[model samples]
Target: MTKVLPSLLASDFTRLGHDIEKMEAAGADIFHLDIMDGQFVPNISYGMPVVEAISRTASIPLDVHLMTLDPEQFIDALAALGIDMVSFHIEATNHPHRLMQRIQQSGMKAGIALNPHTPVAHIQHLLAEIDFILIMTVNPGFGGQKFIDTCVDKVRTLDALRAEKGYGYEIEVDGGINQETAEICREAGADLFVSGSHLFKSEDWQEAVREMKQ
Candidate 1:
């Protein structure tokens, strides 16, 4: 089954608690958090405080996507806060192998994210060291961006890598993932789907998840 993770990047932060509650009731498997620092990405998003709030209210695991430079600086802090997964951009750090080790040592699921321009070979050496790989289908700054069609090809390439290595890593596709794109990713071997705008705009959020599950 494909897992549905609702991104909080597009949620109304003023009423974020309520938004998270609604998503939980709607059967979201994980709460996807997009953390950005203006330098790495184009925009600055919530920091540890906001993530703490989500961690408190979220019944499901927090799938934190760190789109900042020096993700290693904050890994310990986030891990101490008890998030389930912490994903960092492969290009953001100098030592991804050591960083993955630290994350695992801290008892959190370690993940690596790939940008639109990054290739699957960048993570080939560390494939077995990760729990999952997040493929960005859109540019990483904000929400509601158009899906980059070429991402489907990237997803398939990563899927092939995982299969060849017999690694346990899951392929998670973020950005512009709606019902139609979800099918595309799944067919390309994606196991997790991250949706923000489509989820919030849905009339019946839980039913929306059910449809994605199909």
Candidate 2:
């Protein structure tokens, strides 16, 4: 079954607790949190305080995506906050294996994210070390961007690589993921879908989420 992870970036911050409760009730598998630093992604998103608050109310696992210059700086803090998974950009770290080890040691699943332009071959060696790979369908800075059509092929490539190498890392796709794009990725072997604006802006989140899962 496909796992639908609703990105909290697009949720109403004023009613965060209520939105989280509604999403949980609607059967969202994971709560996708986007953490950004001004330097790395050209946008600053919520930090530990917001995440900590979300953790208090979020019943599902927190899938934290760190779009920062140095993701290692926050590993210990995020782990201490009880984050279930932490994904950092492959371009941001020189020693990704060490980071992956550190995250696993901290009892969190480690993930590597690839920008739309990045090739799947870049992280082939570390495939077995991480828990998942985040394929950014659009640029990583902000939300509501249109999906880059070429990224669907990247999913296919990663899926084929996983099959060929017998790896177990989950293929998660973010950015512009709605019901239509989710189905496209699913056919290409992406199991986890991170949707933001589409899910949050809908009048019926339950039906919206259900449609994405289908």
> Which window of 10 residues has the lowest lDDT sum in candidate 2?
121-130
Candidate 2 lDDT, tens digit per residue, 1-214?
A: 6999999999999999999999999989999999999988999989999999998999899999999988999999898889999999998999989999999999999999999999988998899778999999999999999999999998998889889989989999999999999999999999899999999999999999999988
* Candidate 1, superposed: residue stretches over 4 Å from native: none
| Least well predicted 10-residue stretch by lDDT in candidate 1 | 157-166
True-structure RMSD, every candidate: 0.9, 0.7
TM-score of each: 0.97, 0.98
Clashes of each: 0, 0
lDDT of each: 0.92, 0.94
- Give the alpha carbon lDDT tens digit for every residue of 1-214 in model 1: 7899999988888899999999999889998999999989999989999999889889898899999999999988898889989899998999999999999899999999999999888988998878989999999998999999998998898888778878889999999999999999999999999999999999899999889989
